[model samples]
Target: MTVHLFLGPTLAAAEAAAVLDAVILPPAAHGDVYRAAQRGATVIGIVDGYFEVMPAVWHKEILWAMREGVHVLGSASMGALRAVELAPFGMEGVGAVFEAYQRAELADDDEVAVAHAPAAYGYRPLSVAMVNIRATLAAAEERGVIRPATRVAMLRIAKQLFYPDRSYPRLLSEASATGLDAGELSALKDFLPEGQIDQKRADALAMLRVIEARLSAGLAPKQVRYHFEATIFWDSLRQDAAPLAEPGEGSWMQSALLDEARLHPVAYPLARKGALTRLLSRALSDEHTPRPLDDETDAAILSFRRARGLLHAEAMEGWLRANGLGAEEFARLMESEAQVAAVQRWAAPHISSHVVDQLRLDDLYVRLWARAREKQRLLEEAGLADPDLAAAPLSREELLAWYAERRGEGAAPRDLSEAALQAGFRDEPMFVRALLREYHYVRLCEPRER
Candidate 1:
């Protein structure tokens, strides 16, 4: 519903008023047209001559608008060229304002012509009529009122006559009356057919060829080919097809294509295999990664875990299984562990020592599993039975009970508590054990008489 008007340097006050909501003024000294399109306006208008001669800025804006489904209209200067070039994409270009005005004279119906006027030229019949045919066709096309062939014919005439060499007054008069600018001739060479094929048809074919080349070059089928063609069609007509709610919202699949491109080779079977692998991998993965809950969400999740007696390692593992957190689900949650941890820390600023102890136990359990796996591999290589070493594994509860009993009897230093031992194990367990064995090897504790 947003119409963006593009105001040329010579845009009149009345013309500006006609398309106030639909207009986009030309970029300021340091501005960009594409950036303007990103702001959500839907139509752009450029004066006829400006687009043809100074095509740099005009072409960029025109191209951008077409790609983004924003409509572009041109009259007077650049209008003619744009009408011809952009017709395939649905842009409308009028020949001259004077031509529409002349049609007003011949018909002797000022009201019809006035209604037909482009809101820029008032009481100037020639200028009004010049742009009238193009504007009429534009409106008809937009409204689906005229047949496609009828619209094409009107556009063809505008394309042939509304150019630099033609007389503005005569062309406008002829176009207004006949809806064709047939007689105003300067250099007929400029209007001559470019080749055997119609220029517009040829341009469209050329774009298709470019798209095919990109596809053949291994550019993603979704991004460089499909979306590119879709963008062209949308841009040609200057229409916003849909809204992008966020940076990667509508583009996730397209953006994923880049990941596929990176992982796959550009050549043959390997490329095919890699793509298939990636696709299957994604398909097999969980739908959403677990994110660390935000402060409130984390608190909720942690409270749930605690209420269910799932805070410790063994309990958490059982909880995960009972809740159906399999490999795929676990993979997702693991991806968000750091975030979850941050959220938990932020939410529970005054967590009890019991909760802290459970967390440490959970961490140590993971470390123990890793160490067991590593040690098992070493033992297997050394021709030893790894199962024997793995048997009778120390449980967190048992380790804590052993530490508590020793501490109660004053038989171990405070630093030798379970938490300290776990920390020491993580930091330098082999060194600590070597020092212990040197001091206490073969030492015996005497049994006290009951």
Candidate 2:
């Protein structure tokens, strides 16, 4: 029952860990929930997240996690924002910030946003969130430190300022600039040092306490009412968040291999057809009769291997390596040959040039099928793939030169831009980024053959 928490800024990692035992992560982003679910976390708490500098966590990823039976909890910072949007879908929301969002009292995302330090510095906050300022002003009015009208005036000023610039000093300065009386200003300033409310931090702490209580009582996995639909975009995010395949293999190895096949005319059509056929077989499999394994499994497997020219022990081993399988894994597949054969038979009709041509005519089908094929092939090659061997970063100039000379030393491109376009990139910069990523991936691969 491991619990994972993505937190930053609102509460320090040490403070969060003190409230609830959890694997504390920096902040939620893109695939954080998906990856946490993959890691077998039963509960997930999102406290903060990345937005301005990079992509924020996707809503579908949360839905996907809930579908997988992970109890997702949200409050404070990004959590509160996501909770408001997803509460109807089963994400549990905690604290005032979440309530405000749910009631549409705080419609803007910036109400909870704050400038914070880098992860290396423990994500120290540099500026206050608007929600905190609003809470502080409300508290001040309640405490009789300021008039209700003065509090309202101060709130308006705070709201007008950017979230990152909404510090106590700045808020007070703005209040003075807006004709706040000297007596009231003095009262507000004196009260602020110890009386200012940290709404985000309070909400974060409250959420953690809730988590702690639930854990102590042994809470069950959450069940959402809505079905999670895997959109292409969702699928892409999942792939990006997916754990490395086998040791020494990264998630992109299959795509890279497909890219390799795409460059060759003989393999391109075949890869496309194979990809489409595989998808078709998977979609239609539910209608087929059950094909349980029995005594004849081993013999049937041997015959199948022999038919594919894997007749000798060495040939069989080579096939296993290329397909990223261990002997034990190959044996398991052999035991389930009937099921495999059924799918293969069902897919046979779709593995033709005519069908592939029709699929290609539909651009979406072509792209999806290509991605599907890449995934399938990479899954097969995961055991043999070595990510560590290719983990070095390549410079833009180096990548351009490498692309130009990939075929042969003298076959360089007319220019960097030409080379990039020829390599299927939208532009030179995009191409350079891809090349660097690929170079790094390849460097991470293991040196020894599988």
Candidate 3:
């Protein structure tokens, strides 16, 4: 009787492992639940799962699993949300969180959402979940630590902030700033350290106990009444979810294509570095989302089309056909592209802060610094700190040609601002100004250094 549990910051793996006889996995992403069911898991319990960073666990996957005779249960955090949604379909829910969702008292996903460190840190929570804060406030009110009005004001302030930025200290500070009953705020702050309620933890533990009780009572495989339709969308999701397992290993996976890329002498390093930035950007972008997920996805699609010269409908359709990509698949791809663009836009300026550190690490700092200092000295001595390439005896084409040739780049960009971002410059103006200096430095000071 094999069981699998999807858990994360809501409860420690060690604590869940001690109580339940199940394979404890990290937070459930889009394909995780489906993959577990395919692996012949008898029962699956979800305590916590990814809320924003990656594709979420799908409702259809859970329904399909139940139809396939796998008992699926959810409570606390993402589990609670899913349980309220899929309860009519036979998935059992436990604890106050699930009940709250079921009762329609909570609708927003952020109520249970929290920012947390990576798994290496035991998925330690970095921010407070709204449900916990609400519970804590209620407890404070009951104990006469704060008045009812204060609780309302405090919750409003907490809700005003982004989910990731939410914390007890920040909430109290905001209350203080807004001048909402100083004495009550002070009393609530004092009450919070000891009296703070971790509703997510409590709900998660209740779910584990329920799972234990059901198992002790001998759980029969779920016999769902609803017929699960395997649509083309479902088929595509299944294909994407399939693990790239090697021969004789039923579950362990690593892609052969990725291995080939890693083996490439020239491409490997560049690919690895790009992948690292993309991963970081995706994580950051997930939270910010740049207005809304749909809008972000559309914006990414626009950028992608611009890059590939696929802005025209005819050209886009042709490319889509060539790639054998349907509308659904294209939309999914754009979702990921959105994350990349969002990160790039926000980090363009701040990312350069590490330019010196990066150069030092690569052992190129001294050479670059010496060249920069020499350039500064020469330009200043010439009484031309900001050398204007246009004013120089050089045509527009000549300047672009020189810069392009020196940089080993392709044709000059039509939209220099976009190119600037790709090159890690703040904007086209900055890139153009940098080029002006370099062009003059090479032309006036040194003939050329090969």
Task: Supply candidate 3's per-residue lDDT for 67.
Answer: 93
- Count clashing residue pairs per candidate: 38, 20, 0
- TM per candidate: 0.22, 0.54, 0.57
In model 1, the worst 10-residue window by lDDT is 110-119
- Residue-level lDDT of model 3, residues 1-450, one tens digit each, is 788999887999999888888899988878889999999898999888764435688899999999999998898888888888899999888888899888889899889877554444466676789999999999999999998998999999999887756889889888998998888888888888899999988888888888889889998888988988999989988998999543342232346556777899978899889889778777787685553365455445655765676543335545665665655567666666667766787877677759779999999999999999998888888766787755777766677677777878665554465667778887777887788888777766665553
Across residues 1-450, which tens digit of lDDT does each residue of candidate 1 receive?
A: 444443332344354554343443431111234545677655444441221112234344556556666655544333434444555556555433323433443222211111111112211112222234445455545554445565565455555552211223434444456643333222222332221112221222232243334335654211111123335644543443233343232467657766776666665456676556445434433342244434333333333443354433234434555554543454344334334334333333344455557657668757755755654564456444222212324433444444456458432222232223333332234434433332222121122212
Cα RMSD (Å) per model?
Answer: 31.9, 24.5, 14.7
* TM-score of candidate 1 relative to the true fold: 0.22
Of models 1 and 3, which has the larger TM-score? 3
Q: Write down the lDDT of every candidate, Cα atoms only.
A: 0.39, 0.73, 0.79
Q: Give candidate 3's TM-score.
A: 0.57
Give the C-alpha miss distance for residue 440 in model 1, angstroms: 99
Could you give candidate 2's per-residue lDDT for residues 80-110 as a string of tens digits? 9898889889999999999998888889888
**For model 2, what is the C-alpha lDDT against the true structure?**
0.73
